[model samples]
Target: MTQTYSTDWDIEKYRDDTEPEEHWELRKAFMEAHKGNFSEEYLVALARTFTNIEFMGCSYPAAVMRRIAELSKDVAKTYRENKKTKLQRTFVSASNAAENKIKKRQSDPGVLPAARN
Candidate 1:
């Protein structure tokens, strides 16, 4: 017998014990649980611990780790410069979109400018 399921977030998709669980990935859950909770420095530090590839030289592993840390720190530094909240991010995105739309209109030859009072 086939069962119908609704497209929803809260609904568990699987009922059969034999089915392999692939739909709900662990990485997605990890992202959801830790979204906007930690600073970038913390994340870079955490991520660096996970990547432990050894290089050719005696001090290669340490050098690789340091390089990884530097890259992660650079990425974190750019985004966390302002450290805007979720609401702030939303506002910034919306305002940027609106600004872009205005610019597009101004640049488009077919679109007429707004009437001045």
Candidate 2:
């Protein structure tokens, strides 16, 4: 029997096989290159990497992992709050623009109601 594998399935298998140290190094490099501004999903993935570390027998990795998780939580919270504020502002601006257009049309003389037929 032949089995078909999806891209997502292959990607997950590769990621699961990667070393914890390698994952940490890649995340560090990305944080440095991106100035700590990454997607919420990526940040959560980084936090999960701490749990997958091979050195579970050691305490240091656990400590560092806890710290990363906390930091990611904070960043995600702030990102969500900022996104909410931006959406609210956008909605208000759009509502105001629509109101102004209606007012303008009501004042224009060319758009008068036709007399009864």
Candidate 3:
């Protein structure tokens, strides 16, 4: 089971994020070191270290990161519950809207085709 897919598109930042580019200490350090005279192996080692920052996600899809982040967190619980509630609200709203449109159309006799005598 070596199959894997990237979830960066599902990420909020990748979707419609207006936020500035994220900064990381490892990236900053990597850039600083790369600016100096360093051997290929040394740069490779640094790259490896930087990549290790996400070592936990090495074998898992990026989507799992949100689940891991939610583990043992109050915000996660709140988000889950709120998400359900919001979904329910959306369903009700859509149903009502459909019903209203049907009613509006039915009430307006001119909108319907005339019956044959």
Candidate 4:
């Protein structure tokens, strides 16, 4: 009689067994992939992955994670400032348009123009 075993296996166990050098390689690849401006979610996911790398005894450096956090703060600050500026411009444009409309009504050729005092 022949006994068969299940093909399914635990991937987490294999991931945990990865060498420290492999973690460093992965970290380098991650950084390269996100070399330019990135979103908060992407930064967060990279940080989280590195945190796990450390937890797994993969020897990924802690300083990289700190840098990522700092970059995240800067990205958020810039985003907020840009949003505020855009909002201010929209409000100013709308106010100017409304004022122009009022002036046109005041000087309407259809209705008699305002009399000089």
**lDDT of all predictions, in order shown?**
0.41, 0.48, 0.41, 0.49
- What's the true lDDT of residue 72 in model 1? 44
| lDDT assessment of candidate 4 | 0.49
lDDT of 4 by residue, 59-81 (tens): 44678656655544533344346
What's the lDDT for residue 30 in model 4? 46
Write the residue-wise lDDT of candidate 1 on 1-117 in tens digits. 544333233223222354234212322232233334445344333333422221111334777667544544543443345445424423468889888887887777775556411
How far does residue 80 in candidate 1 sit from its true spot (Å)? 26
lDDT at position 74, candidate 4: 39
Off by over 4 Å in 1: 1-22, 25-92, 114-117
Per-model tally of clashing residue pairs: 0, 0, 0, 0
Better of 1 and 4 by lDDT: 4
The lDDT ranking, best first, is 4, 2, 3, 1
- TM-score of the candidate numbered 3? 0.22
C-alpha RMSD of candidate 2: 15.9
Report the poorest 10 consecutive residues by lDDT, candidate 3: 7-16
lDDT (Cα, 0-100) at 39 in candidate 1: 51
Instruction: List where candidate 2 sits over 4 angstroms from the true fold.
Output: 1-44, 47-89, 93-98, 114-117
